[model samples]
Target: MKIFGHRGYALRYPENTLVSFQAAVDAGADGIETDVHLTRDGVLVLTHDEEISRVSSGHGLCKDMTYEELLALDFGSWKDPRFTGERIPTLDQLLDLLEDTSLILNLEVKMGFPYYPGIEEKLLEKIRARNFLSRIIFSSFNHYSVAKIKALEPAALVAPLYMEALYEPYHYAETFGAGAIHPQAGLVEKSIVDACHEKNIAVNLWTVNRTEDALKAQDLGVDAIITDCPLELITALRS
Candidate 1:
């Protein structure tokens, strides 16, 4: 199973910062996961929360501020003082940084109050321009967003992210035209893994932080596992 970095090693580095992403790659992550939201100026920036308070030095909703305004804030200090001046990075910046890294990127689209219109289409265009369609998987908690992407581009590799357990995950996959289902780690049972596998859909669990949890997911036959400490899991798996 491939190991993905959840929010770019949220534990050890500044979550969603380029430094964190590079750290994940350095730690042997097969892929990196990050969230994206369009700024008031329509630039796509990496961040998990709709508000900048948790991960950035800025205050207020991300969508309400222009990219230039967002850039002025320190996105790295909250995690540690050593990373104090690290600014929030644009999606374009990240793509440029990881161009030759051979790491698959999981870009999760985020939409909340004070929304920007046509974020899906905008994000798709950027990805296409970067020619990262093949290396990236588009996932969203809203199945409708996944459906919309599939409708726009039939070949898009859409994945539905679920927090609650489903009775039959394959059914959810089929309904959304999703090639994968990313569920909360605890919600993923053997049967859920089997159901997705039976339909040729991949099962990817999120936020798996420990060595034993990753191995447990691997033992259950998950296709991929997302973690904050890829090195720890990789070491355990190697042992």
Candidate 2:
């Protein structure tokens, strides 16, 4: 199974920051997963939460702040003194960093709640402009966003992310022509994996950090495991 860094080696570095993403590459991760939000100025920035206070020295919804306003916040200091002064990175910055690498980017689009209008178009436009469309796998908890992505770009690889168990998720995924299913680790089972594989749908589980869980996923024939500590998992799985 392939190993993807969840929010860019998030267990060791600040989540979704450029430094964390670079750390994932150094750790020999096959892919990096990140969350995307649009700033008030229409710039696509990498961050997990709709609220900025959780990850940075800033408050309020990320959609309310301009890119310039967000650039001033210390995104890494909250994680560690060593990471202090690390600023929030724009999607362009991340694309540039991954331009020459072979790492696959699983970009989770943050929508609904405090939604950014026209975010799907904006994200697709950026990726298309950079010619980075082929390297991305778009996923979201909101199935509408996933559908919108597939509708907008028929060639885009999209996946539906869900926390709760759904009846025959592979069928749900097939309805949208999704290339994969990103279910929380707890929701995965060997039967589900086999069923998905029968339909040629890849199953990528999330937050699988424990060694036993990773091994279980491997035995279940998962396509990939998205974990917080890429180095530790890579060592455990490869060793």
Candidate 3:
């Protein structure tokens, strides 16, 4: 099974920060998963929360603020004082960080509050311009967004995220034109893995931090295991 870093090595560094992403790259994660949100000034930025307060030393909704204002906030200090100066990075910047590497990027489009109008189109435009579509897998909690991505570009790989148990999750994913199913790690069962694999739908379990759980998922024939502790898990798997 391939190992992917969830939110870019979230356990070692602040989630979604460039430092965390770089850490994942250095740690040899096979892929890097990140949350993407559009800024008020129409820029795509990497962050997990719609409200920046949870992850940054700032206040207010991310969509309500421009990229400049968001960039000014200390995104890393909340995690550690040593990382106090780290700032939020744009999607473009993050892509540059992975340049010349073969890491797959799982870009999760966040949806909840303060909707980013035309975000899918805008995001796609940039990806195509950068010739980044091949390495990206578009995922979202909102299945519509995943469908929209397919409608926009049928060739784009999509995986809809779900925390609850879906009846025949892989079949549902197939109906949505998805190439993979991103089930929460806790909800994953070997049966589910078998079902997905039977239909050629890859199973990439998410946010699995425990080594035991990671190995268990791998044993179940998972296509990839997304984890916050990629370094340790990769080491354990290798050992």
- Model 1: per-residue Cα lDDT over 1-239, one tens digit each: 99998988778999999899888889888999999998888899998889889888779888889989998999988888999998898999889878998998998888545566798899889989889988888898877787888888777888989888887888978986888988989888888788788898999899898887888999999988999888888888976
Candidate 3 Cα errors over 4 Å, as ranges: none
Q: What is the lDDT of residue 15 in candidate 2?
A: 94
TM-score (all chains, Cα) for each model? 0.97, 0.98, 0.97
Output the TM-score of candidate 1.
Answer: 0.97
Say which candidate scores most in lDDT. 2
Q: Rate the local accuracy (lDDT) of all candidates.
A: 0.87, 0.94, 0.90
Task: Evaluate residue 190 in candidate 3 and report its C-alpha lDDT on the 0 to 100 scale.
Answer: 85
Candidate 2 lands at a TM-score of 0.98
As for model 3, its CA RMSD to the true structure in angstroms is 1.0
What is the per-residue lDDT of model 2 for residues 74-157, given as tens digits with 9 covering 90 to 100? Answer: 999899999999999989998999999988999999986788789999999999999999999999998899899999999999
Candidate 3 residue pairs that clash: none
Candidate RMSDs in order: 1.1, 0.8, 1.0
Q: By the lDDT metric, which is better: model 1 or model 2?
A: 2
lDDT of 3 by residue, 1-239 (tens): 99999999999899998999999999999999999998889989999988889889898988899999998999998999999989999999988988789999999998757677898999899889988999999999988888888889998999999999899888788887899999898787888888887888889988888888987888888999899999999999987
- Candidate 1 residue 23 Cα shift, in angstroms, is 0.4
**Would you list the clashing residue pairs of candidate 2?**
none
